[model samples]
Target: MKLLRAIGHLIITIFLTALTQVGGLIWLLVLLLASKFKLKKRYLFPMVYLVFNLLLVPPVAKYFGREQLPVFDKDLKPRHYLYPLLFRNYVVPEMKTLLEQSAEHLKYQSIGITYLDANFPFLDGFPLLPHLSHSDGKKIDLSFQYVNSKHQPTDKKPSLSGYGVFALSEQNFTSNSCIENGYWQYDYSKYLTFGTINDLNFDSKNTKLLIQELLKYPSAQKLFIEPHLKQSLGLGHMDKIRFHGCQAVRHDDHIHLQIR
Candidate 1:
């Protein structure tokens, strides 16, 4: 029982660390306090995690040249509250401004920008797993715009987690070729969506406009999306829009933006 419990704790630690940069440390701290004082993991976990994330991480992150994106805003917002709660929404100040300016440009058209995972606070090289380049606060993912069943634009995403739902069929030739070439992880993001709505349609026009607006910023470096989407959106001429390669998952579901 002791060995099994030790293994369980190890697994949880790794999982938490991978999901949230500081979570494993917090979990270990909870264990330490619990072992010494007979505290409950259930209550202590939330209490300590919230205290560190809410109180300690933000200001400290700012000093490291990172800023947290807002949970709610008129122009830009996170896809889910968990992003900010887990400290997965920190970015360089210029990146934040780029997103805000892009969103504001689309506000008049009634389109809102929904951002996904950015970077972990307080680390220059710590990886934000599943993304090869988000570690430095220079990269972020943005969800694609989608229309509801009624064909009206909505801020709500097809995938509740703002990932995994491919804009077009995942079985397309590019995905198939990549997977067949031993890149099974090419479409692995499909498993990460917490839940999905089946009736959403990709909003091509507004999404294209959003991309255009983002590219207008001098800080904007490049954007990653699928080839099919680039063709579908008539964005083939834009040199800034490029394929992320088979090593990375498909990007039709979202845009990967980077700044210099």
Candidate 2:
């Protein structure tokens, strides 16, 4: 099975190479659409420019002064140093400000949030695996705020695994609950095995507060959630909040916020 999977990946690599092998045209296109602030993949430039990213430079400096905002540097934090490079740039000032404010609010309340992705500094398309629409640096994916089954804030676990879009019915509803080693491991009965983090139950109230907190940002455009979850939140009729529907990953693992 491992050999077959390797063969499959090799085929995919060849296919993408051929598809994007338009050579100069593809490179030029990405350049033309390049963000004025974000340091996109320097595909054509020397790789040495990336050396600074390993230094002690502030998050904002990663953009190399293109004026991009570093929303969150999860990988740069000491405990998370070993994780993949999941941080990226946020270009909208209003969105940036709101995110800072929201993070502060969560911190003040002893709540936590783990960001997963934003625009890849490469293309404005979901060419990257596992995402369908993170292009253009306008969207962000985040682990939902968690609470004990009692709906009270709890310190986020050492690993941000098991957080995802989950049905309220799957939870044990109790006004008093204790956070165990981990909530049920994310159910891979449906989503790809990679999305095993989907079992982390979100505190409905806190998750709703998070969505509301984001909407407070003037640039907030839409919040993609499950239909049932949206209906439960009383946002089913709202214009800016839409359901990602069953056609997509259950999204119980994360929330997608897009800004204008």
Prediction 2 global C-alpha lDDT: 0.50
State which candidate has the highest lDDT.
Answer: 1
TM-score for each candidate, following the candidate numbering: 0.92, 0.57
For residues 41-102, could you state the per-residue lDDT of candidate 1 as single tens digits?
Answer: 99999999999888988898889999988887957999888898878999999999998888
Error of 2 at 84 (Å): 5.4
Candidate 2 lDDT at 235 equals: 69
RMSD in angstroms between candidate 2 and the native structure over all alpha carbons: 10.8
Off by over 4 Å in 2: 1-52, 55-94, 149-151, 155-165, 169-200
TM-score top scorer: 1
Q: Weakest 10 consecutive residues, lDDT, candidate 1?
A: 167-176
Q: Write the per-residue lDDT of candidate 2 for residues 1-260, one digit (tens) a residue.
A: 98996577467545543332222233334444454545564653223223323332234433532113443443111113212233243334455566667877766555555555544444344343345666566776665666655655654531333333354634322201212323232233233323343223457677777777778777888988655667777766667887554334555556788888
Candidate 2 minimal-lDDT segment of 10 residues = 75-84
